[model samples]
Target chain A: MSDDLIGADGRKLTFDANQIRDLLPHRWPMLFVDRAYDVIPGKSGYGIKNVTVSEPYFAGHYPDQSIMPGVLIVEAMAQLTAVVYASAWKEEVADSDEVDTAGRVGYLGAIRQMKFNRLVVPGDQLILKAELGKAFGTLTPVTVQASVGNELVAKGSLTVTERGSGGGNGLQ
Target chain B: MSQSYDELLDQAQARASLNLRVKVLLVDSLGLEIQAELIGDDQPLFGRGLELDSLDTLEIVVMFEEHLSVTISDDDRAAFGSVNKLVDFVVAALGEIPRVEALA
Candidate 1:
């Protein structure tokens, strides 16, 4: 709630996990975004996911070596897109409480030109970014990229279908 | 008479080359199992023809932007009906590539 976290447009630029929970329906284990900042409403946004050894996937993904899965990295980027779109929706419906913007869901329709350049490991803070591309009817395409510090991890374009009244809360 | 015939032949070759390029783009980029030459110009690209889905269409959109330097909007979905239609769409979007450059 710091003034620094608010953009000049009066939109929240940073969101903690508790605030993210209100915009996204994802619970523990599935929710990949830990903290999001530099959010520009629906246009673009940035997020962070701190990969750690305590993650359940690391338990069996290789006890000796823990490499964060590439798909999960992409998922993190998608979640950031969700936050961007949901935040935009919340602004549009600020006066209405009957419509729950938090429940708005976006389903992954297609992943195009995805490439993984590096392996993400435990202790790495995955930085996720998404830019809204074009809207093809209900499907909104987003250009996404993820990196750990300066090392690029994954890049792709994902088309998410906005379902339900506010956009569904599941990835299909 | 022979001069006009040669011009017609040149036009035919240019069209054929454009069609071949479109087919190759679709097969190579989408990893379609069929041979590029086998994809008929008039054959449907979706459903019963090449069985292309929405994802394939999106990939094709990217392909058009990257390779052909042409942008295909959502309104242009009908242009993706077949190899011939796609060639026409690309040609139109590109404002007619010279016959020599197209064949080359």
Candidate 2:
């Protein structure tokens, strides 16, 4: 119900890596989302993940040739959805002190219609977008897409389960 | 032929087609191990029937929106209990079986 997170022009709420860390439970190599922007709280949002050669997976995924795994790209999209859901949860339970909202956790319950259009490599800044779908109890469906520059790299729908209460808001 | 009889025939044919499309969508989107044609119209979609879990149900909801241009709210969750039920919901929402050729 709160529009405080949304900007005046109907755009602009961006989250830095530090801010993202607070909203998501993922960290270290697993934390794929570096930054996010155009967050529309409880609805949809976009995020960025800068893939680099120094990434640990690059060393093993292919010593001869480096390529970001398709599953990781999907994970990035899921993380962005989590951030959107978490922001909405914060607004919904703003006054509730009993719930420890920090480090909210969720798991990828299902993935459907996933199609990888291109291989992501080092130095590619992946733009991830996730749109909220119908909520059935604690399970939330999200339509997600990932792109490098203007070219789409991946697209799919995912079901994410927020741990704790069965509220449709989000994790925690 | 009576006008009512003609209308009933058209309705029956439309329902038949919608049922086929729904089955295809479920198998394709959920990646069911069985063939789409093999799934019985009245068979349960979850648990022991198709072995689909709650997560699959969410995916199925998205498939309905994306493929069929139909919205299945949480309140309509029970409709997803079976393929026949889902097809009925879609038909009711759309007022007709959407032209599958157009969707392709």
Candidate 3:
């Protein structure tokens, strides 16, 4: 078995918005990760979410002060997780005749020890990161962090069900 | 050196309390509807017994790490078979069943 945590072949994987759309089930207002890079397949990756003034939530989240909701930051981290796992699945099926790794979504199993450091406002570029841990059956624990520039926005660990596990409780 | 009756009784009490704590964490962390006291020591944690799916396994793993300071890796998953099995793993890892009062 290969002992490398980061696969050499998958390290070069990157995703733009259109490529991310092909991998994730999220769309429109729900899609948080605008771009992804430094991907090591199922191991770890980084993503970017360009927080803009035109975001729908800013209309009411406080018309006066537009701070990005902390939950959305968590959701963005989850989406980046999907990219990591989905990209890994794609690598597994690369040589196969039927390569259908599109729209594979991972369900959030549990979020733990999340801490929001500072407020995320409009015109901020949210940098998201996730690193995979040992799997507990189909549940894989991911350590995630979201930041704007050099300032940390949120940091935590969360568990997500593996892709195609079908562990969804009819929420899909 | 042989052992006193009181010492043995205290150890037994600690083990019993540990079993209940494991059960309580399983229920609380997994968001199970049943009460902890209702769970039998020998009852299976997955499948037909507790009906816990794969998603709940990670919560139990984290619970052990955060509360008991025991790291249950995938290789040690046999500990997840039952409540008693989990407590036994913890006791084995810790080298003793720490008394509830002592833990406090």
> TM for chain B in all models?
0.86, 0.86, 0.91
- The residue-by-residue lDDT of candidate 2 on B1-104, one tens digit each, is 55698888876777777788788888877777788778899998877888887777777777788888888887888897899999889878988776563122
TM for every model, in the order presented, reads 0.82, 0.79, 0.73
- How much lDDT does candidate 2 score? 0.81
Measured against the true two-chain complex, the DockQ scores of the candidates, in the order shown, are: 0.28, 0.43, 0.43
List the global CA lDDT of all models.
0.81, 0.81, 0.82
Q: How displaced is residue B57 in candidate 3, in Å?
A: 2.2
> Residues A1-172, candidate 1, lDDT per residue (tens digit)?
2436787677658888998998888888999999888898888989999998899988877788898888888788889999998888877887876556555666787776699999988889988999987665556778999988888889988887676664443322
lDDT string, candidate 2, A15-86, tens digits: 789988878878898999998888877789989999999999999889899999899999999999988888
In model 3, which runs have C-alpha deviations exceeding 4 angstroms? A1-12, A163-172, B1-40, B43-54, B65-78, B89-102
* Candidate order (lDDT): 3, 1, 2
**In candidate 2, which residue pairs get closer than 3 Å at backbone N, Cα or C atoms, i.e. clash?**
none
A9 Cα displacement, candidate 2 (Å): 3.3
Q: What TM-score would you report for chain A in candidate 3?
A: 0.87
